[model samples]
Target: MVLNDRIGSARFVTKTNATTLDPFKATEQGYLGVIVNGAPQFETLVEKVHNLRSVFDVRNLRKLSEVVIIYGYQDDPEYMYDAAISHHADGIIYAGTGAGSVSVRSEAGIRKAEEAGIIVIRSSRTGNGVVPVDKGLPGLVADSLNPAKARILLMTALTQTKNPELIQHYFRTY
Candidate 1:
């Protein structure tokens, strides 16, 4: 089955086959393409969809905020994190090496970003594997999501709230 989790572009629960698609349902769920299944076998709450859409609408109209993804490397210089802060990014998804571990210098930059009111999410550049919560880490973990997916969720989560706990909950949930 083509589950939403496997379809990189799917925003919500979607199932597809060869024929018969529901464009309306896909649109409602924030998808632009066709779904060959009847209705979505799984559905997200209307309230949730509304909230996500509202945030996207405001962002699209004003361009007041942005979400950035930065890759971590050995002996990292932290320039990308600093740049994100300077650019007024609303959120950052740090794709750290191995299980989302950043170099000392990069961590310092992350701390500065957090101090600047930018929410930082720790994800892995390893492509697959959960970035579990580490007490030593300065930001929320991205769970099993890769950097790109983490960025998408972080962008949506930032719209509803900046509370690290709540955003972390979203990472664990949707």
Candidate 2:
């Protein structure tokens, strides 16, 4: 079950012409209702709806926060640093390889982001498994969420608070 938390995921509700589905329309006024996955074989759509409602109560929706995701690779960390600094990002998700293990350059960049008061979230690029919490990272682990979902959750969390401790709690709980 690939559960996408992005507001753009409303395409799942449409049986056809998915391109016609508008994310802004779905979330602009408020969550009108659950958009059931049109694929009948995915019978768990109802449960997914219930879970979504329980986890992200749209009634309490607030302003969207700006969270950027940085992809980790053998490349330099300059891009990561730029996202936090130049973009004035409120939060950042580092898509690290395997268990959210950071490369040396990425680590250096992350520290800079932290120093800038941008909440950093460590997410897995490998697409599965929880990022084990590392006290030395000066950031929150993404739990079982991948980079994309981590960005979404971090954006939502930043809306509530900028405290890394409180944001970390959201990472663990949500």
Candidate 3:
């Protein structure tokens, strides 16, 4: 079975056994489709698809910017966020406790990062649950994305644009 999803301008495909396919759940989760019965030819699938660029297309590839992820803890020091700035990172994903709630000191560091033109993304350290937008926060929210996924998206987004609003839109859309 082939499961497909799009991220930014990239299209990705995942191949799995047909017996493991769950059609309803896959579609509900926004997967493109599933092919059952027998193993499908991989080359035929890619060759027939039009307009979509190959994942290995070097010409269309953009060099990803540096993104750091900091795990927030109770009374944590601001060193992690500060280090990202010192290292000249393009973005920081804060994996905060609970629904992406950062420590006071972490928030202070995030403020400094924002001032230095680095984009900050608030994501939950918890395995699941959405992190909503908090206007009082210094940077953008990562929605339902975990810290790792948020970091990947942020790196790609930063390569395209530095606009906070546009980056936030990418979080919402992708």
User: Which candidate has the highest TM-score of all?
Assistant: 3
* Per-candidate local distance difference test: 0.73, 0.68, 0.74
Taking all chains together, the TM-score of candidate 3 against the true structure is 0.70
- Per-candidate TM-scores read 0.67, 0.65, 0.70
Residues 1-174, candidate 3: write the lDDT tens digits: 243322111222222235764321321124333344544333223323323342223356657889999999999999888899999999999999999997889999999999999999999987557789988877899987778888888887876789999999878766
In model 1, the worst 10-residue window by lDDT is: 23-32
Q: In terms of TM-score, how similar is model 2 to the real structure?
A: 0.65
Off by over 4 Å in 3: 1-35, 39-62
Query: Relative to the unseen true structure, what is the C-alpha lDDT of residue 117 in candidate 2, on a scale of 0 to 100?
Result: 85
Q: What is the lDDT of candidate 3?
A: 0.74
For residues 1-174, what per-residue lDDT tens digits would candidate 1 score against the true structure?
A: 233322223333333334655321232234333334544433323324335534344544444337998889998887788899899999999999999998999899999999999999999887656788999879899987778778877876776788999889888776
Best by lDDT: 3
